[model samples]
Target: MAASLAAPAPAKGAWLETWLAAAPAASGELALVQQRGREALRQQPIPSSRNEDWRFTDLALLQTLPLTAASPAPAALPEVASGALRLNWNGSSDPLVDQALPAGLQQLSADEIAQGLGHTLAAAGCEQHWPVELNHAAAEHVLALRVTSRSQVSLELVSAAGAGLQALRLLLLLEEKAELDLSQLIEAQGSGLHSLVIEAHLARGARLSHGLVALGQADAALLAHVAMEQEPESEAQLSSVMSGWGLARLEPRAVQVDGAAHTTLRGLQVVDGQRIADTHSFVEFKGPEGQLDQLHKAVAAGQGRSVFNGAVRVPRAAQRTNAAQLSRNLLLSDRARIDTKPELEIVADDVKCAHGATVSSLQTDELFYLQSRGIDADQAAALLQRAFCEEVLRELPAAARSWCSLERLLEAAV
Candidate 1:
């Protein structure tokens, strides 16, 4: 392990001060946000084991990433499907340059960007989270757009960073009755920090299907927060797959602003070597008759660690809310560790909410059965891991599923 990445926490402000000092001067339309983020981070120290929410995750891995910017050096990416628009983001340049967007999809004007930015994050109650502040402090540009009412659009975003720090911010609005299919991919080639924050709002009757695939190396780290707000009659489906990071933390938050919306969340993470992966998800029902279904899975091998915490809330005003959350984990090594927590808080007598979690190793009987069919022991174990991950992988959009191969995921897990 790299000593810089494994070093225990540093004195209160030493690490962050160095990183902030090296960041480019705050400028552009987001100058205010950047300034505020810096101020917030300066006042708060890196979260440690004492903080309940970050108790199991370590931020020490962030100390050594180069303060200088890295160039884009993504691996060979998969081809996009026919009729889908693909945009490559280099973290410093505008991705929409020289490309024509399809009808019904347009970039938001400066005024619109100012008004819509951070709206969903506030609605999801994570606007001031530590990771979010970090993104706000560093990100200089945002890709903001709107899908016209009743229009259907397909979009893909790809980013690959070499080394150092890369920050990306995105905002999406689905107007009433509109539909959008969005697939995003983030990959890292060397030691660095990848920071991402996404906020989306679904108006009444709007629909959004999103898939995210993140891959990293043993010395890289990733911090991401995806927040969404849905109006009545709207629907949102989000699926994510992650693997191979020194440390990765993902936060997905959703809010049914006025109830009567449908939200489906699925996540799968694979950790091997000495890497760590953690996911925290929250969903709240603000009005009656809301519906939610969430499932999260993880695979841990070697001395890697996996952690998951899922929370669902149904207030008194959210009567008739229906929600279910489940966490499933696979432990591939005795030294590996897995922690799963699924929580539900319901104050509405008429609401139905349930949550559960399970952690276990590969099924001995299943492995034996596969080996009896002439499959080698290693192949049998790989097959079981693949089968276990397919449930969530299959939920990804077609293009994302094609880009994120099943074999690649299994190879990373075991």
Candidate 2:
């Protein structure tokens, strides 16, 4: 049986208080938000295995991480493409300083930021999540922007963490008929905690395509939340890939405010050694004619563990909704573990909803055929793994695809 999270033991209650007390005082544009987050943390217990959403995840790695803010250290980053805008964030300095933005993109005004900061999170129903709270408590600044109507833009945001807590926050608002392609890269250099929260609002006829690639070391942990709200005629495509984190939890939620929107989600995660990777995703259609297509894949080797829970909701008002979700996993070792659940709740009789999950290893016949064709056993296995991951990796934007590849992901898993 799982113990209560409120238990005063070392791993449950006391550690949170200690960590909060050690954190720096909040005083900035985000001061009130930070205070609220601290209060929420104090009121709630650290999420434990007792929580259904976190049942397969362990929070012990966070106790071993530094609780203070991370200092800005120089990073070695990839060069930017000729026509693309690139921003390097150290989790402290303003990436917009002395930079010029293209015609379609502009920094949000103070009033706009205040009004739109948490709207999508609230719409997606994840504003108070523990990871979001952690990000709110530590994040000092936000990168807020708006894409003007009928404008098209491409951007790349990169962050590399050192030894401490790194918090990243972003808010994006896309106007009617606007389009934006955003590629984000996060790399962990040493032992620490990296927390991130992103909220995006897509107006009517707007489109947003986002790709995220995260690579971490075994001593570090990551928590990330992405929430999106879509108006009718809008579209959202999100693809994420994560590898090599000691512990990682990613939650991506989307809501079609009045339905009639299109949403596509793709995710791939690879874990080796004793690492853990978990992804929980949710999508809801509130009105008629919404569509969703989602696929999640995981590869677990050694004694690693992988978990995925995907939920889709179609309410009574959401007639003519079409949604499908699939979870596929690969187990490479006897001790590796995988937990996958794809759930759909539909109250509308006219809606078509489907969900399924599959777990399997490399096909013996395929491996034999590869070995018979003169490929070594190890190389054959790697070929199969690469093929498995490419399905999702190919969905990334061109710029983001250049930042990570199957070879790099495979190497990181080791």
Candidate 3:
């Protein structure tokens, strides 16, 4: 049986209908999947404040936007170094992948994607989620990456759209003993709405290191969803950094299908002006000896708002599970707001679980100490802020840890 979550309330107005009508036609098994997604959208309501999961997020702005399919003209491709596969999706341009692939990696074509739609659709269960269903119904193409052996590969996923609405879907598969390092960068230009959905599967002993960074224009809104399933002895590490979007939501979910699995999640969100950044994550352990460590940090300046909700579940069969979650937030302005919740539900008596949350401002004594040591006030504050974010950034893959754009964003935030 497929697992389900409460769908976002049905969206108001004809945005859905209009977007659906404008979508390109799909054939074969892919068509069937889109049909199912369309039907599901017709049945599910857009999420509203009434829904507990979306209570802190106001969808008024999203509801008022005139949504349409993105149609940006193709621009010159950016220069990227060798040794990694780069995919650029600008809603209208043809998807691009590196010319050469590593020994154990393969990229799936449209026909191959169509043939595998059924399995992918089943694993995603898009019928139960609104954003995911919309992605399924409107995505221009399906991008898939398959790893079949003990290999190390880097992927750069770039999403840029013009005005209106854009959606993209990515599927990643790691066979037994396989490993992958993925870096996703979302750059939303102009005024519009963008949605991204990623589905990944890891077989026994497989490992995945995933990182994401989102940068958006002043009027852009984004919704990103990531779901992963892991077999016994599988491991996953997810790290994310967000900023610049007017309104954005990042949701990542993981399930341990067998025993002795390990999962780690870390995130840092920085917002200024009137922007809002929200993150919601869920992790479930289905068997014994599972472990999870999660930490999320937010820094809000100006009148920006940051929201975080993390939940971890340890079922009855998940004995000897170890889980810890923490949410740390810093407010740089009196007007800025931070809302955080760390939760755990453990049904096994042998499990050890702990959760905590903190909302604070720059420590006065620390600032004073820095000032006394010859640093100016502004420099002191920036240093402290950088240190606070390092806890999460340090966990990113080495190459991604030094992302220039990310570093600049952090400096600007301070």
Candidate 4:
């Protein structure tokens, strides 16, 4: 059973107080949700080395940040072609749409959203994580999207930063037979903290593909959490690329309410200097005939560090399930570090599940093979690195795969 968010003492700590003072006021259902979030934070202490889930990542810098609300800033929408929904957030809401939305897609207002907030929160199992509660407490807006058609649509979420904390919340629902292609770009420009929570629900026969890119300043910190619920015959694919943050953590969780659902997760992280990038994922199958394919790759240069932990759970009822998880990493410097753990837990009698993790440096033989072909050492290394990352990058949607910014991101890594 999840922990109860009953009446509790007000949250303490300078960071909590700063966030509360800067946050905007809410009323009615929204206010109640915020209060519950506050109580949850008060009841549970901050995570530290004592917690197994967070042992590998340090939180000293996060604890000392002046975590206030992000101040409003003017942001121009990115240059996206028509037929895309662009949402720019610089402590305010600016939605740019070049084309009209398809028939079954609509955005919900705060009051309209409150009607279904309870079920949405419950379905996401929000009580299990603290960062989610913090997001609920500080998020200034609740951007809710509902899709009910078989049409293809694009969504972009852009987050601009201020001097303090930036919190954002998103809820997405897809009815039966619906399809959506979503992309999110987060850019933090200053020395502060950013938190985001995304809750998604996919009904039977629904399909969703999500892509995310996170770029942060040298002194910035980021924490992003995603929760998804899938019904029978539903499918979801999540692809993420992250870099440039001083400290960052990305957690994605999915649960299959019924069986026969398909879930795919792919992630790539490139970090250098003193940056730290961490990703943790969890997928649970509750019924039979479920399938999951997961791959996570990381490249660490200079004195950077990369961490990954992925787990898939199949209960007794989840018979005939097929799941595979792999984590591959590369280290370019002696001082760089990579920690990866891929896990599978199965209680079913008949199921196929496999998990493996590998950590190595650029192979001398492979590098030599490329260099011998008339390519300079630097160019050869870059070529090899790009090849290493392409395995996961190719899994993105074609539109996202063709983005020039993504090409620049890979070049910058080299």
Task: Evaluate residue 18 in candidate 3 and report its C-alpha lDDT on the 0 to 100 scale.
Answer: 64
Query: Over the stretch 280-304, how does candidate 2's per-residue lDDT look in tens digits?
Result: 9999999999999999999999999
| Clashes found in each candidate (C-alpha, N, C closer than 3 A) | 0, 0, 8, 0
- Candidate 3 or 1, higher lDDT: 1
What is candidate 4's lDDT per residue for 186-249, written digit by digit as tens? 7666778888888888999999998887777668888898888999999999998887888889
For model 4, the stretches where C-alpha displacement exceeds 4 angstroms are 1-13, 21-29, 71-78, 90-100, 109-112, 118-126, 402-407, 410-414
Off by over 4 Å in 3: 1-11, 21-29, 64-66, 71-82, 91-98, 109-127, 404-407, 410-414
Give the least accurate 10-residue stretch of model 3, judged by summed lDDT. 118-127
Q: Score each candidate by Cα lDDT.
A: 0.90, 0.91, 0.78, 0.78
lDDT of 2 at 364: 98
Q: Judge candidate 2 against the unseen true structure and give its global Cα lDDT, from 0 to 1.
A: 0.91
Instruction: Give residue 36's lDDT in candidate 2 (0 to 100).
Output: 94
Better candidate by TM-score, 2 or 3: 2
- Which whole-number lDDT from 0 to 100 does residue 228 have in model 4? 88
**What's model 2's lDDT at 64?**
83
Stretches > 4 Å off in candidate 2: 1-11, 73-77
Candidate 3 colliding pairs: 8-46, 8-47, 9-45, 9-46, 9-47, 10-45, 10-46, 11-46
Residue pairs with backbone atoms closer than 3 Å in model 2 (clashes): none
Give stretches of model 1 more than 4 Å off: 1-10, 411-414
What lDDT score is found at residue 331 in candidate 3?
95
The clash tally of candidate 2 reads 0
